[model samples]
Each structure stands twice: as C-alpha cells, then as structure tokens.
Target: MLDVLRVTFPFFALVLCGYLAARWRLLPLEAIGGLNAFVLYFALPAMLYEFGAGTPLGQMLDPVAFTVYLACALLMVAGTVRFSLNERIRWNDAAFGALVAAFPNTGFMGVPLLVALLGATAAGPAILTILIDLVITSSLCIALSRLDGADEHGASAAARKALRGMALNPMPWSIALGALSSGLGVRPIQPVMATISLLAAAASPVALFTIGSVLARSQIVAAAAEHGPMPARDFVPVAVAKLLVHPLLVLAAGQAAIALGLPLDRFTLSVMVLVAALPSASNVSLLAERFEADNGRIARIILLTTAAAFLTFSAAVALVGPRG
Candidate 1:
C-alpha cells in the first residue's frame, strides 16, 4: 500500500542515490567508512541518550520478550550450524554463515524504518533492539571468528579479545551509558542535548545511504572476481536459515510474548518484530574481513540478503500486522 511505500521509499531512495553517486565516482567509497564511524560514535549515542532518557525503562524492559528473542536467535544459530555441518561446509564458514543469517540490520535498517513508519514513540524498542544487536547478537560474530580460524587463542585470550572488541563498539557504549543515565536521572545540559539531537537526527539517513553504497560496492567487487555465486554452495544452507527459519522462530517467540500479556507498547512490539525481520547486518562483512574469513563470499551474501530484505521485511511486517 501507499502507506508502506511512503515509509520505505525515502530510505531506499537515499540509498539508491548514494550508491549511484559512489558508482559514478562522485563520492569516495571511504566516505562510507567515515560516515559509519560518525553515526556509531556520535550520532547514534546522542539519539539513544535523548530518546532513552525519556522512556519508562521499567515498562520497556520485558524479560519475557528479551528471553524469547535471544532464545530464538540462539536456536537459529544452532540449527544453521548443524545444517551447514551436515552439508560438509567448513566449520568456520558454517559459523560465519550462521551469524550472517541470524544477525539483522537492526541499527541501520530497523531503527530508521521503525521511526518513519511507527514514529518517534518507537525509539524505545528501536534503541533496545540496537543494544541487543550490538551486545548479544554481534557477540556471535566473535564466536564465529573463532570457528573461522582466528587462531586458537586460549579462552582467556578469547575473552579478552571479545571484551576489547566490545569496548571499541560505540553502539554498546552509547546504550549502556544512556540507559544508566536514564536510570540515574541525569539530565544533560539543554544545549548539549540539542547538539546531540542534531547529530542523531542525521544518523539514520546517512547510515542507510552509506549502507546502500556499500552494498553496491559489495556487488561490484563480488562480480569482477569469480569467487563463486552469491547463494554459494557452502553458504546455501545458511542462506536458507536466514531467509526462512530465523524469521519463523522469531515469529513464534514474538507470539509467545503476545500470549503472555506482556506490557509491551505498540511501538515496542512493532520495532522488535522489525528487528527480527531485518536482513543480515552490514557489519557481518566487516567482521569477516577483519577476521580474514571468506570475505569475498560473505560480501555476496550481504548483497543478496540485503536485496532479499525488500521482500522478507515487508512480508514480516504484513504477517506481524500493525502494532496494537
């Protein structure tokens, strides 16, 4: 319907324009990196602080919904790994594949879409979803790194590495600090809050646009070199899990939350489902590249799923229906 397209088109348009500009050599590809850094470090944190500070944290923090979401994600990861292993894919590939399939584009795609379609009131669930993605779901990426041959660092070293990796992540820092400030009732200076609001306001459009450019780049780079097809042989099982199984599990989990009579607001439920429906995080490719996983193959999957998201996400929204 027009309502859905109205919500979606601007986001997609921004991305399309950014991608074309990048392809035409009008914008440096490195700008995407810089933009991502700015959004994560400054813009998104400010947004979280401002938005989270006003939310009734007690109301939104539903243990039932949280548990259900995490359980569903973990189950999907386990199932994907098992299926990939059965298919004879390397353990590392299976792990990475599981991660890519399980993780959603929550920060980049879910937040903005929820904001536009659902409104500012939706920020509570959107921010919470971002925290979950950065803190919990992304941790799976680190686990996958181990499976992918990132050296057999001891458990302590692995713990240290995961901690170090998490420390540098601006999303978690922002959310943790923001949540604490909210809980503690710390009020930022009005002017400072305003400045942060400005930056945060720009975060979604800029980040999503850059993601579009990055996806275009992924497709281009993936094409010139023949590493294998997108739905790669080894990655097929993972893709199937991502495109099908994960969402089903999330739906079941969400329905359970509904049945439990949790106090989730309309926006919160909507955003949570949206996060559940998102395609793979763009960060998966970044993680694969950093850990020296099959970067080429992962790049293709990112593009493929991102494009596939147009359908999957719409279907999810339709299935979940409008929030109560």
Candidate 2:
C-alpha cells in the first residue's frame, strides 16, 4: 500500500496544485481553456503518437480487451441513466450524468498515469480505452440525451456532429499515424522526433495539473451561480458509480471474457479496470453546460469522484496494480 501511494501520490498532488492555483487565482479561470488546449492538442497527442508508433498495433487494439471494456462501459451508461434520472425524467441531465459516470478521464490522466504504474507496455490498453470512451461512450450518451425530445433530426444531427468531432480529434489520428509509421519501419528526422519527445514528456504532469485547474474552475463558477442546491440523491450515486461501480464492473466483465476463452490478457484487463476507475472527465461539465443540462450536478460528480480517487485509486492500484 505504501508503495502504491508512492507511485500515485505525485499525480494527485499535481491535481492539488492545479486546484490551489485556480482557487488562489494563480491560474485564472479563463486561462484554464488554454491550458486544457495545450494538453489536448499538443502534449497528449504527441505522447499518443509516440506510444502508437512504438507499440505493436495488434497489442494496442486487442479485440478482446476492447470488447470487454466497451461492454462494461455501456453497462455503466445504462445503469447510471437508470439510477440518476429525476422524477421529471430529464433525459438531458440523466444522459450527461451517465456520461460523467461512464467516461473516465482517460485522455488527460489515464494514459500517462497507467503507464507510470504499469509500464510502457501498458500504453496500448490505456490508449485503447481512449478510443472506446471518446468515440463510443461519448457519442452514445450524447445520442441518448436527445431521445426525450423525440427529435429524430436532432439525434441524426448529433450523431453526425459526434462523428465529425471524432474525425477531427488528433489523438486517434496520432495513434493511427503512429501505427502506420511503425508498420512501415519509418523514422522521422531526429529534430522532429526530438520535438515530439519534449511535448510527450510534458504530457503527464501538465495534463494532471490541468484536471485540477478545471475542477477548481468548475467549483468556483458553479458556486457563483444560483444553480440550486444539488440533489445528493441524483449526483452522489453517479459519483459512486464512476469511482466504485464502474471498475468492479470491468473486473467482472474481464473475468467473464477470460472464462469464455477470449484472448483478453491480464495486463490489458488491469489497465482497463484502472481506466474505468478514473474520475469523471472534467470536460463533461462543459458539455453539460453547452447542451443546457445541469452543469452543477455534473461538476459535483466530477469533483466528488476526483477528490475520492486519490484514496480509492491508490487502493485499487495497491490491490491490483502491476506490483501485485
């Protein structure tokens, strides 16, 4: 346990620093977007490209791992939606809540953290979860949010928009291009690779810090507004779902897959479980606000899961990490 804490402590401490920076106005709220942009567009993509370029494509996109992880993710979506829906049956809040629960912060946090705890080899499954959550889990929840409106056109448009967003996402493209480069035995000029190496190195600590800054921004903004008192009944369950239920679901699902004679490797399964254990994606608050959902509740869930994850995630790693 102490060993696990040593591995996990610095990661969460960066988060704490970001939170304090935002709370103390060391990092302005508006500047949070630029910080996040630097991570998403630059550091993270560079890291993904490097990982994809070096890793065997087959090992990264294992069908068994993908299937088990996706199945558990969908189950999380359905369960969260069913549990968190209000008496008004607002599909928008319910759907976004489900998304917050189902979608881990895989991009910003999981890829680098998992690799640190596991190994460079763990990068494949970590990136694979990004594809599952970014492309599949996010799109499905967005679509589900439209169901209550019965606007077939809206749903179709949302689907198109989701696909378009995926098309434009640099992470998946980086992975693909990296894999292709690896397949061809091609190497970039040392200067270009050196630039990528610099950015990739910045990814872990910066991304983790950005998560705290975003969380702090959300908390301050939500407090400033009259978003009404959060219904603990509504949001607390979703947080629990993300932190506790989701990882356990993945564990069971992975075991089941293995029992069924699938090729889901233990290392990939462990990575999937840890990814599932991640706190809610911070961007869900932004998405909820955009869609006119209850951003306050969404933010609360993210905050709750993140604060708790320092302990819970460490325990999870202690129990099931590579060292185990």
Candidate 3:
C-alpha cells in the first residue's frame, strides 16, 4: 500500500542511490570501506548506546524474546549445516553456509529500518538480536568450521579467535555501558548527549547508503559466471531459509512464548519478525572469502536475497500493521 511505500521508500531509495553512485563511479569503491568503518565503529554504537541509556533495563533484557530469537537462529544454522553435509560439502564450507542462512543483517539494515518503521523502542530487541548473532551464532559457526578440520588444538584456537573478535567488537561494550548508565540512573552531560544524538541520527542514512555501495561493488554477476552454473539446488534453499523461514520461526516462537505467559507485546513481536526477515549480513561473503570457503556462492546468495528483501520486507510490514 502507499502507506507502506511512504515508510519504506527512503530506505530502499538510499540503497539504490548508493548502488547507482558506485556503478556510475560517482563514489569510488574504496571510499565505501571508510563509510562502513564509520558506521560500525562510530555511528551505530552511539545510536545503540543512546537507545540503551534511555530505555528501562528490564525492557531491554526481555528474556523470552532473546531466547526465542537465539533458538531460531541456532536451529537455522544446524539445519543448513546438515543440508550442506548431505550435499557433500566440506564441513568448513558447510559451516559458512550455515552462517549465511542464519545471520541476519541486523546491524546495517535491521536496526535503522526497524527503528524507522517502528520506533526507538524497537531498537532494544534489535540490539538483543545483534548481540545474539555476534556472540552465540558466530562463535558456534566458527567452532563447527574448525572442529572437523583439526585436532583439539585447532578447536581451541578457533574458540579463542572467535572470543577475541567478539571482545574487540564495540557494539557489545556500548550496549553494556548504556545499560549500566541506565541501571545506575547516570545521565550524560547535555553536550555529550547532544553529540551522541547527532551521531545516532546519521546511522540510518549512511549505513543504508554504504550497504548499497557494497552491493554495487560486490560484482555478483561476475562472481556467478566465474563460479560456473548457479548451484540452484543448494543456493535456492539457503536463500529461502534466510529470507522466509527465519522470520516465520521468529513469529512462531513469539506466539509460543506468549502462550506460555511470557511478556512479549505485539510491537516487540513485530520488530523481532521484521529483523529476522532481513537478508543475510554482507559480512558472510567476507567470512567465506577469509576461510576460503564458497565465496562466490555466498556472494551470489547475498545479492539475490538482498534484492528480493525489498518486496518481502514491505509485505511483512504491511501484514504486521506497523503499530510498533
């Protein structure tokens, strides 16, 4: 409906603008890294911190929502890994494939998009999902990828690496600091809050634009050609898992939680479903390339799912009735 379009157009349009800018060489490809760094390191954390500091700690730590979202993600990862094994893929590659299917783009796309469609309150669950993906889901994938390849030492090393990476990530720390401040009722000086507000305001548009630029530079067509004929049998299912199954699972989980007398409201439930419905993170392709897994396959999957998400997300929001 036009109402949905009015809510959703700017997000996709910003992406299209970034894509066209990159395609036309209006913005150099190298510049996207800087933009991404700005989003990841500075803007997003500030936004999350602001949200966390302002929200009630109890609301921020919704146990039922966290458990359901994480359980669904783990289920998808396990299911996809099994499917990959059945298809004769290596364990490492299969693990990466599982990640592609399970990891939603909660940071760049989900947070801004949901907050815009819903409200600042939506950021709480969105941040919770982000933390779950970064800590539990990613570490599990890394462990699985290494488990079959090496002995005990390799598994330890992989675990250590995952932990180290998680430690270095700024989002968790920002969230923690914000939660601490909120719990202690510690308010920032007006000037500091003002600065954070400014940075937080920039997170959505810049992050969306950077995503578009990344897509333009992904060279998905070239990767598909070089990788040979589409692995339709494998790729189609993973894409479906990411775009469709994940959200449905979240919705079902939420309903189950409410049935059990958990305190999930409609708006929060809608936000969780919307966040789950997002495409796989672009970083999944990077992880594939890093581990020398099926990078081309993953890249193509990202491209297809991201393109398809526009309609799917719009439909989801329409159906969910945007009351959040």
Candidate 4:
C-alpha cells in the first residue's frame, strides 16, 4: 500500500545509500567497523536506555510476548538446523545457519524503524527481542555449533564464552539501567537527558546506514575470498527462513497465545512479528567467521535477507502493522 511505502521507503533508501557508498568506496570497507562501533557502543545503547527509562516496566516488555517470541525463535533454530544439516554440512554451519534464521537485526534496524512506524511505545517489545536474541538464541546456537566433535570442556567453554560476551555487551546493561530508572522513578537531569535524546535521535539513521555498509563490506570480502562452491541450497533456504518463516512462526504463535487467554498486547504482538520479519542479523556473519564456520554462506544469507526484506518486511509491516 502507498501508506506503508511512505513509512518504509526512506529507511530502505538509507540502506541502499549505505550499500552504494560502501561499494563505490565512498565508505572504505576498513572504516565500516568504526562506524559500526560508534553505533553499537554509543548510539544504540543510549537509544535503548532512553526508551527503557521512559517506558513503564510493564509496557517495556510483555511477558507473554517474550515467551511467544522466544518459543518461535527456538522453533526456528530447531527447524533450520534440521533442514540445513545434510551430507556435507556439520553442526557448526547448520547452527550458525539456524542462528541467522532465528536472529533478526532488532538492535540496529528494528528498534528505530519500528518505533518510527508504530511510535515510541513500540520500543519496549523491540528491545525485548534484542534481549532474547543476544541472551538466549545466539548463545544456544553457538553452543550447538560446538556439538559436532567437542569434548565437554569445549562445549561448556563455548557456552561460558557466549555468556561472558553477553555480559560485556553494553546494550543489555543500558536496558537494565533504564528499567531500574523507570522502576525507581529516577529521572535524569536536563543535560544528561538531552545528551541521551541527541544520541537516540541519531541512532536510527546512523544504525540503518551502518547496516547497509556492513552488508556491502561482507559481500566485498566474501567475493574477494577464495569461496568454495555455494549451491543455492546452502544459503537460499536459510535466507527464506529468516525473511519469511521466522515472522510467520511469530504471528502464528502469538495468535495462538491470544486464543489461549494470555495477556499479549496487540501492538506488542505486531511489533514482535515485524521484528521477526527483519533480515538476519548482519553480525551473524562476524560470528560465523569467529567460529570458523562457512562465512561465505552466512554472508550470502544476510545479504539476501536484507535486500529482500525491503519488500518482504514492508509487506509484513503492512499486514501486521497498526495503521493498516
């Protein structure tokens, strides 16, 4: 619909701009990391903090929404792992594939864009999705990745490392502080709030642009590398799982929850579905490279879902969107 397009076009256009800029060397690939660091370390945390602090803890995250979304993510992980693991592939590749299929780019893209489309209140559910992905889904997938040939030490080590990384992550900490502030009625002083406001305002455009640049950089790197034969089967199905299947699972599960008489917020359910509809988390490519999985396949899936989400995600927004 024209109405939906009007809401989504600029966000996707910024993504295209970032993609073009990186491809054209306007944003050198080396510099993409720094831009991402800025968003991750500064802009995004502040944005989450403000949203968390301003919202009532109840509205900040719906328990029913969390359970439903988590269940959907777990289901996606299991399903993708089952589907992707075949003759050649092992748990490492399939686990990361499952991760890509389960994790959406909620922090970098979904929070800001969804809030813009739906309003500030959407931030609670959007941020809640980030917590689920970072804390549970990613950790579960990475732990599963080591299941191929690892001893108990290696497996436990991988899980510990994952939890440690989550502890170091600033986004979750900011969300907690924000919730604490909300809980205790602790409002910030004018200047501090103003700084957070500015950073939060910058979060959307910068994060979106960085997502485009990261996708471009990944593609550039993958193309330059000595990539092995990547059949469409290896990547395409996983990409489809991310852009299409994940959201559908969320929708179906949430609807079922509502039928079961759970207290799921209608707007929260819509936000959760849209968040699930977002492309595979771009950072999954980095995780793949880190764990020595097939980065080529992971990057392709991220790129494919991101590019396709321009259409699929828009349609999803229109379908579940509040305005509609």
Candidate 5:
C-alpha cells in the first residue's frame, strides 16, 4: 500500500499544488491556457514521437490491442448515446454526454502518468487510444451533434471538420512521423533528440498541474449550485459509465482478445484498462460548451470522475501491478 502511494502520491500532489495555486491566486487562472498549449502542442507530441521513434514498429502498431480497445470504446459510446436518446435528452446533448462517457483523458493525464507507472513502452497503447478517441469517438459525437440540429452544416461537413481538426492536431502527426522514423531505421540527430527529451520530461508535472488548475477554475461546486441540484437521473449514469463501465468494458475486451489468442500481453492489457479508467477529458466539457450542449452537466461529470479516479486508479494499479 505504501509502495502504491509512493508512486501515486506525487501525481496527485502536483495536481493539488496546482489546485492550491489557483485557489490562492499564486498562479493566475489566465496562465493556464499558455501552460496547456505548451503541453498539448509541444511537450506531449514530442514525448509520444520519441516513444514511437524508439519503439519497434510492430509494438507501436499493436493491431490486436488497438482493435480491442477501439471496439470497447465504440460500444460504450453507442450504449451511452442510445440510453440518452431513450431518456429524451436532446441529440446534441446526448452526443456530448456520450463523449463524456467514452473519451478518456489519455493525453494530458494518461500519457505521462502511465509512462511513469508502466514505463515508456506504455506510450504505444496510450498514444493509440488517444488517436482512437480523437479520430473516431470525437467524430461520431460531432456527427451526432449535427444530427441533433446543433450545426447548420450537414454530416459530410461535420466529418470534414472533424478530419480537418484531426489533421491540424500535432499529436497524431508526431506519432506518425515517429513511427515512420522507426520503420525506416532513421534516428533524430543527437541535438534534436536531446531537445525532445527535455520537452518530454516537462510533460508529466506540467500536465498534472494544469489538470488541477483547470479543475480549480471549473468551480464545480458553484456550477452545480447555480444550476441547482444536478439531475441525478441524467448525471449519475454518465459518471458511472465513464469511471466504472468504461474500464470494465476494456478489461472484458482485453480478456476476450487474450482468450482468442490475440497477441495482447498482460502489461499492455493493464495499460489499456488503466487508460480507460481515467476520468473524462476536461475538453469534453469545453466541447459541450462550444456546441451549446449541457456544459454544466459535463463539467460536474468531469469533476466527480476526476475526484473519484485517485482511489479507482490506485486500486487498479495495485490489482494489475506494473509491467515487469
């Protein structure tokens, strides 16, 4: 237990530090955007690129693991969307809800934390999951949102927008380039590799702090209060789907893959489960707000899941242990 805490405590502590800094005005809220940009646009991509560039191409493109993970995520998204529709939730709001239920915070928190917990090799699966969510899950949600009359554009336009957004995202491109380098057996020059290492090193602490700062700025309690009591009927299910159901599905899928003799290994399976167990990405709420969905509800879901994740993640790590 102490061993587990030793590993998990620093991650949460950095988050707490950020939360306190924001609460005490030690780090002004406005600074968060710049910090986030640094992580998203620079640090994270470099970290992933290095991982991909250095890892064997086969490991980087573990098709069995990627397929299983994607299947589980799609199932969760479909189930959530269906349930929301049955409950008479607006389609656009339901789409965003589905996103909250399915999209894990793989980039900001998952990548760095898993790298720490499972080592650099975990980066392959982590990056794969991120690409899956960004490219597939997000596109599905955007299409649904459009169907719900949220957009003036049609489905084709929604897809084009999604594709364009993904193309513009540096993470996927970095992963691709890194994989290309690995495949071609080309390594970055020493100076460039050193620079990449420096940026990658900053990813974990800065990203964790940024998460806490964002949480502090969210003022979840105030949002809940102003919105009145959250409709338990609506909120509880989404939170459960994200924090509990999502991980279970991933675990089930991985187990099934192994039983069927897929090349999935225990450590990669554990990494997939842990990543699935992460709270909904903070950006889900932002997406909701942008699309004029139920942003308050999404915000509360992010808060609840994130708060609960410490225990859930710690328990998961203890049960799964780390990759040998």
Candidate 6:
C-alpha cells in the first residue's frame, strides 16, 4: 500500500496544486485556455504521433481488445438510458444523464497520466481507448441530446459534422500517420525523434493544469439555476455507472481477453482499464451548457467523479503492480 502511494502521490499532488491555483486565482482563467490550446493543438498531437507511430501496429490495433471496449461503451449507454427512463427522466434530463454515465475524460487527463504511469508504450492503448471514447461514445451523446431537443435534422447533420471533425482532428490524424509510419518501417533520425520526445514531454502537465483551470470556472450554482431542479438524488446513479460499474466491466472484459490467451501485456491492459475509468469529461459539462442541457448537474458530476478517480486510479495501479 505504501509502495502504491509513492507511485500515485505525485500525480494527485499535481491535480491538487492545479485545483488550489484555480481556487486562489493565482493564474487567470484565460491562461488555462492558452495552455489548453498549446496542449491540444501541439503537444498532444505530437505525443500521439510519436507514441502511435512508434508502436507496433499489430499490437496496438488488436481487434479483440477494440471489440471489448466498444461493447462496454455500448452497454453503458444502453443501461443509462434504460435506468433514466424507469426513473421518469425527461428527454434532456435523460440525455444528460446518459452522457454523464458514458463519456470519459480520455483526452485531458487520460493521455498525460497514461504516459506518466505506464510509459510511452502504454500510451498505445490509451490512445486507442481515446479514439473509441471520442468517435463512438461522444457521437452517441450528441445524437441522444439532439433527439431530446426534437431536432429532426440533428442526427444526419451531426453525423456529417462528427465525421468531418474526426477526419480533421490532429491527434487522430497523427495516430493514423504514426500507424502508417510504423507499418512502413519508417524510423526518423535520432535528432528528429528527440524533438518529438520534447513535444510529447510537455503534453501532460499543460493539459492537466488547463483542465484544472476549466474546472475552476465551472459555476455549479449558476448552471443549476437554468437547468430545472438540481437533481441531487439522481446524481448517485450516474456517478456509480461512471466511476464504478464501467471500470469493473472493462476490467472483467480485459481479464477475459487475458484468459483467452491474448498476447496483451498486463501493463498495457492496465493502462486501458485506468483510462476507461476516468470521469465524465469536462467537455461534457461545456456541451451541456451549450445545448442548454442541465449544466449544473453535469458540473457536479464531473467534480465528484474526477475527485473520486484519484482513489480509483490508485486501486487500478495496485491491481497492475501490487508489489511495486
């Protein structure tokens, strides 16, 4: 346990520091916005490219693991919708409720933490999971929310928009390029690799701190004012699905994969499981606000789940390297 603490403490400390900085307004909120841009547009894409490019395409793109991830995401979304309907949730409320239950903070938090804890190699699975989360889970959330809005044109328009967005997204493109490089056996010179390393190194902390800044600005009280009642009682179930049930299901699926004689490294699988366990994304809160869909409830959920992830992450690490 003490050993686990040593590995986990530093990462949590960084988040704590960011939260404190935000709470104190030590940095302007706009600083976070700039940092977020640098991370998203530059550092993160470079990191993804280098990591994705460097990985053996065969291992990183395993069909079975990918299938398991997709299945888990689909099941969670379906379960959330069913539960929401049974509880008499309205359309927007149910949409946001399902959103909370489905999406993970795979980009802002997952990339950095995976690189730190599991190394560049582990990043392959994290990146894969991020793709799954973003492309599939995110699109589903948008569709459900639009349906609730009674927007007939939304489904088709949103599909086209999502396809275009994904096609143009730098990180995903970088991943595609990287896989191509790996497949073609194109290794860069040492000096070029060094530059990629430098960019990748800057990705995690900047992203994490920027996320903290965003979290700081979330006005839970104000969001509540606009989005009907606060729905405090309804929150627990969403939190459970996000912070508990989802991860456990992923873990079980991973274990089954392992039992099937899959050639997966335990460390890689652990990275996937941990990334899968992350809370409802901060972006979900932003989207909820944009669509006028219960931002306060979303904020509360993001805050609670992110805080809970610290302990959950430690447990995940212990599961992976209990003796380390």
The models' CA-based lDDT, in order, is: 0.69, 0.86, 0.82, 0.89, 0.82, 0.73
- Name the runs in model 4 displaced over 4 angstroms: none
Q: Show model 2 residue runs off by greater than 4 Å.
A: none
Candidate 1 residue-wise lDDT, 269-309, digit = tens: 55666776677777777776666556666776666666776
Cα lDDT tens digits for candidate 5, 201-267: 8888888898888777666433654646657877778888898899889998888888988889888
Alpha carbon deviation, residue 38, candidate 6 (Å): 1.4
Q: After superposition, how far is residue 79 of candidate 2 from its true place, in Å?
A: 1.0
Candidate whose lDDT is highest: 4
lDDT of 3 at 128: 84
Provide the RMSD of all predictions against the true structure, rounded to 1 decimal. Answer: 2.7, 1.5, 2.2, 1.4, 2.3, 2.9
Candidate 2 C-alpha lDDT tens digits along 1-324:
898789888988999999999999999889999999998899989999998888888877688888888898899999888877767548888999999999999888887888888888888888888888889988988878877766667766777777887888888888888888878878689999999999999999999999999999888877787546765787888899899999999999998988998888887888888998989999888777777777778889999999999899988888778532
What's the C-alpha lDDT at position 127 in model 1? Answer: 73
| Quality of model 2 by C-alpha lDDT | 0.86
Clashing residue pairs found in predicted model 1 = none
* Better candidate number, 2 or 3, judged by TM-score: 2
- Candidate 3 residues lying further than 4 Å off, grouped into runs, are 86-88, 148-152, 220-227
| Candidate 4: 10-residue stretch with minimal lDDT | 148-157
Give lDDT: candidate 6, residue 292: 70
69-174, model 4: which lDDT tens digit per residue?
9999999999999998888799999999999999999998888788888888888888888999999999999989988855767667789889998998999999
TM-score for each predicted model, relative to the true structure: 0.87, 0.96, 0.92, 0.96, 0.92, 0.87
Model 5 — TM-score against the truth? 0.92
Higher-lDDT candidate among 1 and 2? 2
Model 1 misplaced stretches (Cα beyond 4 Å)? 86-88, 148-156, 220-237, 257-267
Better of 2 and 6 by TM-score: 2
